[model samples]
Target: MKHQSTGESLSTYSPLLLFICFLISLPISAQDEPKISVGGALRFNYNLSSWKEGQKNRGGDFGYDMFRVNFNARFKGVYLNAEYRLYSDAFGGGVLKQGWMGYKFSDIDEIQIGLTQVPFGIQQYNSHNWFFNLTYYVGLEDDHDMGLKYIHAGEKFEYHLAFFKGAEELNFGSETESSTSRYSYDVVGRNKEINQFNGKFVYKFGDKAANRLGVSAQYGSLYNLDTKENGDHYGLAAHYEFSQDRWNVKAQALTASHNPKNAAGENRDVLKFGAYGAPYQVAADFNLYSLAVSRNIPVNLGPVSNLEFYNDFGYMQKQKSQFTDSYMNVTGVLVTAGQVYTYIDYAAGYNHSWLGGNFKDDFAAGNPDAKWEARFNINIGYYF
Candidate 1:
């Protein structure tokens, strides 16, 4: 995973300090009117992997998966939610995953302020596959930013609107470096102007066999500090979700266009993708599609009381005809017994697609000359 690093020391510690202050100032009531809770989850993974001809690293590896701690509190009509995540160098590092406070205007409406998930394509999980999908790789899905969020829900309709400062912790100094490419698509290595906006609307039907259709869009401006130039990013998406009993399905398609300012000496026509530090120059427009289906089995085996099988397919195409398109396929099984859960995944990449592409840079494995590659992963997790 590549990420854009914030060049200043303040950007690195301000959020953490703010969270600590908020926790310290939290007032506990003696009347027992307020509610508070603490909880967290820990995950571990043991994996055996192989790489393509030009890729680096191979063989079996084992270590910590991730650790996240959360805090929640409610008093009167106000609520506070926060979470902190810790990961090693191999995974990432300590960071604030989400921190937000909201005031309930009514049972069906509320306004929230602070860092939160950018409500766009999918609320949480966007794909059934272990590697997720291409949208995740480019930061179109499951992306988070500092913003003001508003949400309203009714019997048959729901709406989410937000204005964001920019992608969080985006580093502008070394925008093209690979180390800072993980997470959001801060490929331009610039913080966005305050004009970034995200909007989503969904409609529900069919009570028995639940069905939902939604439309989402985002628009933002990126200003690079290095060249003193600005860029533009905008996207539109449509999605459908259906569920009945133990069967569920989800599908989404999106088109995004970017106009990144040419690096000081680069061509203006080429735009960057991926992350700021380690980016790929490509055409200005691209399309992405994802589909997933899963079924739960009632049979219990040993400690595994719940079992599910899922398959996911994803495709990506660039507007430039000569640019090689990419696709991915993932099939996995999940088993859970109480707090302990395990997953077995088989993932394959075609053309320039890189398996595990969402978590790390796979430029080496994504050679145009390479036909395909595959990986098998076993992940175990426990929640409390």
Candidate 2:
């Protein structure tokens, strides 16, 4: 131990050891820089209605109270985005709304994988960062499904494609068959399985009056059913936005067809008695259409920046062989006439139907061939 080793001497050098520690800590300090952000919104609504169907209530009531959370992160060329939503008596008994991950390829193309909203309509593709009337008019029921999607966006053009699980309904087995089975079946097992494919394209005009146009198509199949009974649907939509001002116009149309196996004669009596039986087959075709116009106004307040006023109307028709021709005609309006700090949205609507009355047996009882429903909704949302 007359001469200390070089390693031992270096470890004992206080100044040198301090310098090394500083060098190692520098990179971590840089790497720890903030690279993520978080944001979200909460929405609540109240509805008052007097209808000819079901139950009638006089006082106002909470309609849909929703809470949403979002996260965004990025580093270099990689990015991640996700959202989760909670609904109280809304969104069908509070189910997982949306969860997905995306990858960017250059600035033109991207791919997303997970349980995401299907990009088949203008409303489904709009950014959810703001609270607006787009969600109400664009229609939200059929756009959410489990699948993967590809997107390509350019200066004047954009495209999207998606694949998803199709609509399914529970099918129960007969009492005789259920007795022999070792276990009872739930809704999931009885559901018929299907798959869907969809595509969309958009183009923007570069004229003095800025405007954009879009078109879309879709095809789907039910694997377990025959060709005629399997499900298929298609749709088309368009929009025009004025560049100089805050005005826009949009329209959309969609149709679907299905043919289920005809088990009417064999299962009619058993199904009527509430016993498990094959579903009665019905050949049906459904169609829907919507149109609207909207304008945004400038306001003077803390980011109380914009206000919007809009009116929307839609119609749906379904024809089936099992019953008299069925159709639903509905018209609704939305008005946001005040500043963001103080806003009012009044929605009033009416629906008329044929083939089925407001009550389940209203039509079957031969009481009347037509039924009507009237509703009114008002909501005020604000952020500070």
Candidate 3:
């Protein structure tokens, strides 16, 4: 499948099912006891696209995007954090984005076990726009997996180290689960990610400017079910953020390589990554970079209190001579009013997934005459 947006059937689990079930509990009243709170959001989306001629001609669709539940609890040194999402059945129904239980060792140290965000690249996000940067499409940004994570924060530095056993499998059936229908991209169809190690260190400098610089590195094993052997992949990144007053700027440079021991007669130059009910191919070796800038402005329009104007750009350069490069540009504004937030973006992509590329060759095979695709989108949500 070329770049697409959708989801499919989810699998059943055994123990983790029970654990997540335990995590999904009733929202109790807020009191002065051990801290516990439950909150969530209701989101809707509307989009007009240049790629979807039929949809654009007939007018874009406006509908419910998702409903989520977030739960957090803490007692003494033990704490729990989890989020579950419910999407339209066409988008794979319900899935757990993240759920983890952890213990605090000290004021600056803690450990988290279960599904957690990988310690790679920028901490929370790499872009100001909702679509994020190009790194996100290939599982480099905001990616999460089943792992044990250690975090430490000092006066001038922050450290994150993690060891992931593999991707989270929630199926109880006998069939090998399709890696599609997930929130983050991962090796699928005969390969799975496993035995990964990640480390990231950030230094805070220029107290007057609130600047941060960080480096991230990760190496992991890719296990092929058919081959019964391990391939390997690694990623390295350097990122920076500079913030002052109402302005924030971010920049990142990263490179990644994946060598999968696919079954005989399979191509090694391209690998399939599946997520959100679709699979797309990407060059096995490539470098990516992104830059984003935003300015937060206080506004007074009815209940609206804040507005942010931003532009985010990303480019991917493939190492192979036969493959084509990809680039994306998003110019957007965000509006916040009370508990409501909205994003309006004009996103353009060339030889990119989720933009207009066919599933097989968008990021792998070259297309010198690749046409640019654009999408105008608006997403609004109410958080409680």
Please tell me which predicted candidate would have the highest lDDT against the true structure. Answer: 3
lDDT of 1 by residue, 1-384 (tens): 455564445753454456556544655434448789999989888666456332335456767877889999987556889888777654446666678887766789977767788888866777865567767766776776776778998779989998876555544344532234344554443323334789999898897538879999999876555565667778899999988888889899999887666456754433444532345544457788999899988766777787889998888776655455677878998888889878888888765324533323232123355556677878888878
TM-scores for every candidate against the unseen true structure: 0.81, 0.62, 0.89
Per-residue alpha-carbon lDDT of candidate 3 for residues 230-300, written as tens digits (9 for 90 to 100) = 89999999999999999999999999999999889989898888767678888899999999999999999
TM-score of 1: 0.81
User: Which candidate model has the greater TM-score, 2 or 3?
Assistant: 3
Measured by TM-score, the strongest candidate is 3
lDDT of 1 at 74: 87
In terms of lDDT, model 2 sits at: 0.43
Over 141-254, each residue of candidate 2 has an lDDT whose tens digit, in order, gives 334555567899887888988775532222232211111110111111111323667788878776643666777666654332212233333445544333347766666566
Residue 38 miss distance in model 1 (angstroms): 1.6
Q: What TM-score would you give candidate 3 relative to the actual structure? A: 0.89
- Of the pair 2 and 3, which is ahead by lDDT? 3
The residue pairs that clash in candidate 3, if any, are 1-359, 2-358, 2-359, 181-277
RMSD of 2: 16.0
Please give the lDDT score at residue 40 for candidate 1. Answer: 92
lDDT of 1 at 176: 38
Regions more than 4 Å wrong, model 2: 1-34, 52-58, 62-64, 89-91, 125-142, 165-193, 223-244, 260-283, 301-304, 319-372, 382-384
Give the least accurate 10-residue stretch of model 1, judged by summed lDDT: 358-367
Arranged by TM-score with the best first, the candidates are 3, 1, 2
Model 1: per-residue Cα lDDT at residue 367: 36
